[model samples]
Target: MIHSALEFLTQELNSFIKLKVGDPITNRVVLSSVTNEQGIAIPDQSLGLSLINIEEERTSKDQQNRFINAVGKVEKRNPDIQLNLYVLITANFQNRLPNNSSDDYVEGLKQLSYAVAFFQSKSVFTQENSPSLAGFDGDLKKIFVELYSYSFEQLYNFWSVVGAKYLPSVLYKVRTIRVQENAIQQSGDPIEKIYLESRHKP
Candidate 1:
């Protein structure tokens, strides 16, 4: 078990609202009664995925394949290490409001959430609402955060399957990470308590 699982998040997030970090290096954290900088319930860390930009970099399909291949080669050399990508956007724009176009600072995070979902082959244009993870016995709130975050990964928005959910296309703030599977895989990973629903479950 990771020392962080039982130490950091558990000790820090015992109250109603808190940003608990069980395993910082693994990106596994907990959010209870807590709101993000945007006043949104951040939930658990898995939902707080680091976004990885999918913009047109002219990497050429072959070059892109090479990059992925390199990642796989490293993973093969170190089975304990799990590599991942994240995206982060740093622009401030305004959406027209009654008074004026107000800028949402947390827009970066939100946009990134949309991006990851889109890359997974999902689109939000069909409706103003977001999609659900089909009750996958995990931190629904964190997953919800993911649903609400990200950026547009490609053109001609579409939907698809990723990890274990159907996602929509959008924009986002991204990043990349590598961790040992034996450590925390997500916010509420096993040996840790990032699962908010579990705490409230009947």
Candidate 2:
């Protein structure tokens, strides 16, 4: 196998997953993406790649940069294949109060999405830090913690309300990569393929 073998091992992995792991639900395998294993291919690290470089409850840009730096370190260690990263953060982190304005709320979400696209292979997830644009689920007094059991749920609802008030055009951008030339040209596609015919049965 070539040094850049993982660059095209999706086909092999697809068959393996079908036989061993079954179809994945939340995240899908990036067809053109691969890792640095010798003859065998590896799955994208989503199963293992989790929320890392997380700060002690901070959501400032500085904290975001810290995670970006972590991604850089992973790249240096695995130069042959790029590492997939997903930065996880909550909106309205308990510590920092976001600017009070509908526009600011929308702007923040747009910024985070842009950051994800720019940080390819390195995406960020924000489930906790959503700004409560519509105000606390009902006044901050009522028998709370009942309807919204967790703060996370409240945050989710908050962002939902904000989006309803004014949705931002935060389009997600996906990139496609190809091999300049496969080292195993004689071996056919780095990924394997199933055969087909007209028709057949017992």
Candidate 3:
């Protein structure tokens, strides 16, 4: 589910960016890590969407293990785990052109701004609004995106930990992707009564 959600986001953003720019760049946005295992930059002249962190959404934690099925049988399953994902959108562009050296840098910022605009226009995504999401086989109904800000020190620490130089980037918090197992732990008939009558005197 996590992978599906991120992939969906990357595709949608790429489409929007292409529509705005019309630069004939195939896959201007992609789901990728900023650096590889060797700590080398992986993407250039493109927007990289990377999962930076995952935090459980404790408030939505399910406590009930039992639920009634459509056939009226009681079934027990473990509580689902809800998670919020922190993703980083980074733009990597270099001065590759001798005549238009600044074009890459300027285009990087342009692409990044379009990304922010796309999210701002629509912060929430649902199957109704985003029909492409229906292609994924799951009950992931909706997702919310919000801008996440960081202090200067926090940003420095993050870049240091990732072993990469800072580029034009933005952080967003994606809310509430659910993880659940389909297997039922237990099953039983529904309880109809709490007590039974004693007919004889003790």
Candidate 4:
């Protein structure tokens, strides 16, 4: 489900970028880390989508009850695991512009702005909005996307840890991805009622 969700987001964003940029610029949107181990540039001017963090949704408990089988027995099942995924989308453009102009920097900022606007306009992704997610094997229902802000110190530390220089990027949190198998673990007979009887002697 996580993989499918991220893939769907990348595909949707790429489609939007293509429509906005036109044929002159090739579709460079990719699901890849902003930097490689060797500290080399990521080939071309591309928008990189990377999974930076994942956190379990801890506010709510998995309170789904056991399932009832055809024979009226209670079937024990594992609770669902809900998660939120944090993704970093970075625009990696060239550092130097031709003719000594700031075209490269400007382009990077522009791409980042477009990315933000794209999410702002449409933050919710569901079967109705994204058909690709709909085709997933009943794992995904809907995903809400929101911008996640980072403090300056946190951002600097993150970049240092990743061993990459800061680029024009945006952080987004994808909420409420559920993972459940619904497999019965154990079965037990249902208790119908409790009876209390007493005998009194005169």
Candidate 5:
């Protein structure tokens, strides 16, 4: 489920970028960490979508208990896991110009801005909104995307931990990814009826 959800998001974003930026940008968007094993740079002028954080939805914990089937049989099942994913999109642009670094910086920023705008315009993915996501075989019924804000200190710490220099980037929270297995652990017979009797002595 997680893989399908991420793939759907990446494909949607790539399509949007291509439509907005045209064919000039040859680099395709990728789902990867911002840094390599040797702490080197990512691909040039490519949008990197990295999963930075994951959190379970505590509000959905009510379904952890056993459920009763339609035939009144008691069935034990595992709790459904609902998750939220925090994805970071970074625009990695190359500084082809030897002396001037501002051009590269500007290009990266421009790509980031485009990404931000794209998400803002389409904050929700559903059957009506995104056909690709809707057609997915997994349990991805809907996805809500919103820009996640971080303090400057937190942002700096994140980049430092990721072992990468700061690049033009945006953080988005994808919400309500559900995972469930329908395996019944146990079952019990249904109660058919109750008997009552009253007696009086003369």
Candidate 6:
């Protein structure tokens, strides 16, 4: 579910950028970390989308493990776990011009702005409108995206932890990625109906 949501956002945002900038040859958005495992920055001139953190959405959590299956039998299974993901989109444009005619840093800022505008216009995604959502036959329903801002100290700590210089980036909070297993723990017949009786005192 996490992979699907990330992929969907990356693709959709890339498409929007292409339409706006009229660039068909290059992908403006890509799923990549700010730096590789070797601590070397990737040299792609595209916006990199990386998962920064994942936290469970406990408010939407349910403890009920029993439900009626399709065969009209009560089945017990673990409840689904809802999650919120923090994804960071960074502009990784390089200064490719020999004569410095155009500044890639400024170009990166432009791309970053486009990313913000893209999500502002379409903040919600569903399987109905976005059928390309991988393996969203049921269970996974909707994905809500909202901008996540960080305070000065938090931002400073984050870049320090990442061990990289800051680039033009935006953070988003993606809501409710549900995870559940199909295995049933127990099964039983449901009560057909309840009957009420009147008692008379002697």
TM-score of each: 0.19, 0.17, 0.91, 0.86, 0.84, 0.88
Candidate 5: clashing residue pairs, number: 0
Q: What is the lDDT for 31 in model 3?
A: 89
Best-first order by TM-score: 3, 6, 4, 5, 1, 2
Note the Cα lDDT for every prediction shown: 0.27, 0.26, 0.87, 0.82, 0.81, 0.84
Q: Of 3 and 5, which scores higher on lDDT? A: 3
lDDT of 2 by residue, 125-162 (tens): 11232222113321111110001123556446644643
Model 4, 7-121: lDDT tens digits are 8888888778777777535766688866776773454567788899999998886787687888899999888889999999888777654664333777778877878988998
TM-score between model 1 and native: 0.19
Better of 1 and 4 by TM-score: 4
lDDT value, residue 76 of candidate 6: 89
Give candidate 6 regions above 4 Å deviation.
100-103, 134-138, 193-202
Q: Which sections of candidate 5 miss by over 4 Å?
A: 24-27, 68-74, 96-103, 192-202
Of the candidates numbered 1 and 5, which has the greater TM-score value?
5
Error of 1 at 194 (Å): 47
Stretches > 4 Å off in candidate 2: 1-86, 89-99, 102-104, 120-202
The residue pairs in collision within model 3 are none
Give the Å shift of residue 156 in candidate 6.
Answer: 1.0
Total backbone collisions for each predicted model: 49, 10, 0, 0, 0, 0
Top lDDT prediction, candidate number: 3
> Which candidate wins on TM-score?
3
Q: After aligning candidate 2 to the native by TM-score, how far in Å is the CA of 137 from where it should be?
A: 45
| Candidate 2, poorest ten consecutive residues by summed lDDT | 139-148
